[model samples]
Target: MSRIRATLVATAAAAAALLAPLAAAPAASAHGWITSPESRQGFCAEGATSFDCGEIKYEPQSVEAPKGSTKCSGGSSYTILDDNSKPWPRTTTGTTVTFQWKLTAAHSTASWEYFLDGVLYRTFDGGNKQPPSNVSQTIEGLPTGDHTMLVRWNIADTANAFYSCVDLHVVAGGTDPGDGGTTTPPVTTSPTDPTTPTSPGTCSAAAWSSSSVYLGGDQASYNGQIYRANWWTQGDTPSNTAWGPWTLVGSC
Candidate 1:
């Protein structure tokens, strides 16, 4: 009986030791990403732009890598972000703009850096303290034209940083400064010619909407062509023919 009791005591001690580190471990590492003016990952996660975004569609906040990289992915494994060929929707704004960040796990910060066309333009100190879930940063005196802005959220406690890339079509005196989140509306044909197709053939389906959900076999007209959805999808442009959910049925 004494020997059996000793074995049980030893087993309990070992179990407690194994559980100690588990209890001390930190919580899940959830990071953040830009929302307003929509980063590349943001558009992919929202399914509003590209359809070929691999794993980034699920993990927009995970574009984290070591510091000192200029690429959109920041030298992370998310190489899709570095592909500028993707049709990232550009936000139409004036010379001044405000970027909104959505933080999932706001860690201790070092500084926020912004680069326009690979040139450092602004940096905000983080005071070495944790930040709130929602943080907004405004950048002023931007030049007018198409520009790619790279944002970095450097962590004070770690060598890693979160990166986001935003494409903007800055006009001399464009959108209201207060309307930082708004995007340029897509051009559409007149609705008075509903019976008449925008192209050569008759439009047999409704015009595709970015906000509408399309299921399998559903048809929609886009870019003078009629497309059929292979499966359920939303926010995916119908003109994406290569491996997208849309299949070009014919010209409308």
Candidate 2:
């Protein structure tokens, strides 16, 4: 009986040791991506039927970079979100639409911005507090046509921002465009030729300056390539490094 009791005590101690880390682990940081209108990352995560997306198909909530960039993927390794050549699934909605973001980990936010054709269409101030697991915002007065909508979440305390791209087909009062709708014009240039000219009226490349604070949607030229900043940033060079502030859009 004495031996048995000693063995049980040792077993209980081992079990307690195994459970300590689980009890002490910190809460996960904010991790999420847009779901409604099916953002590019969302579609990829859901196994998109229209196009073959890259790694983003598995982890939609992982597209994160420093605030002040405009790229859909925020310069993350999920660069597939930036590939505008492939036809994306479009969600048809009215001039005013409610966009929804699904969150796995909620974090305090600085703000949420919606961009249409590289223009700020709407913005929601988050008040620097934790939001619900699902956040929704209504945007109005969008022109009738196809538009690439970029949803950006700016974390209040962190330097990072989450990004998702939703290709939208807004109709004034007509029928839904369905998933097989018109495609937005491609914005990225081929990697084979860095100097290849992009579509007319697209964002032009400017020289990167450490003194300049770049906002989302701002483009810069560095190392013979054109990069788009995901959010406000300075001093981060646009190189081949992953998770940097700048996403390589094309060769300059």
Candidate 3:
């Protein structure tokens, strides 16, 4: 073969090899964010806030970056999340709050971390396995006040982690945010009644019925525990675990 023909073929092969990776490179595999207690991204995605949210409103699950970032954006391109100047709506809650996450592409997770205004407060073992599409974790003994929380979902096999920020206005005896701004009414009792409980927390809530429709903050007693509905639900049994729409408030 002629030298020029051989040289031309070799150059073409090299160019193709260089361009192949650029054409076929895959995007990073990461997804998920706290939805309940409505994270900043969650509020944006739901159109619950009036401020401009940029692309994050459309892709709430993509705030991913290296695992070490403390920023709400996780150092990703969604920097609008880090802006405190925006009037971000805060979830009002009691000392105990339940956080729920929605996963589009679940990964083998290493751990889940919760930070309150940049301080690590709680963590859950991910078991280094894929998680369900809907996952919930409740944090007990949370300090009451207005605060920002940063949540991290660490991938087991990758250096990337998903980050979300949630604003909370925790007040004493406050109900969960989804409860539509009303506090549970105090149970009434007569002084002549000998069977009435002395404490409100110990008072028996209305018994949960399978045929009844309940809305957010609606309380009922189920299996000796007091449970509150996170949202409109019917026939879902109240549970203390992270799997159901009912949140176990305390023992009746």
RMSD of 2: 16.7
TM-score to true structure, per model: 0.61, 0.58, 0.65
Kindly report which residue stretches of model 3 are placed more than 4 angstroms away from their true locations once superposed.
Answer: 1-3, 6-30, 177-252
User: Per-residue lDDT of 124-233 in model 1, one digit per residue for the tens?
Assistant: 99999998866778789999999999999999998888999999999988763333433221112232222222455788789999999775447898888887664456
Tens-place lDDT digits, model 2, residues 181-220: 2222122224332224344343457788888866434678
Question: Which of the predicted structures, 2 or 3, would earn the higher lDDT when compared with the native?
Answer: 3
RMSD of each: 10.9, 16.7, 12.2
- Of candidates 2 and 1, the better by lDDT: 1
Ranking by TM-score: 3, 1, 2
Query: In order, what lDDT does every prediction score?
Result: 0.77, 0.72, 0.77
TM-score of 3: 0.65
| CA deviation > 4 Å runs, candidate 2 | 1-30, 174-252
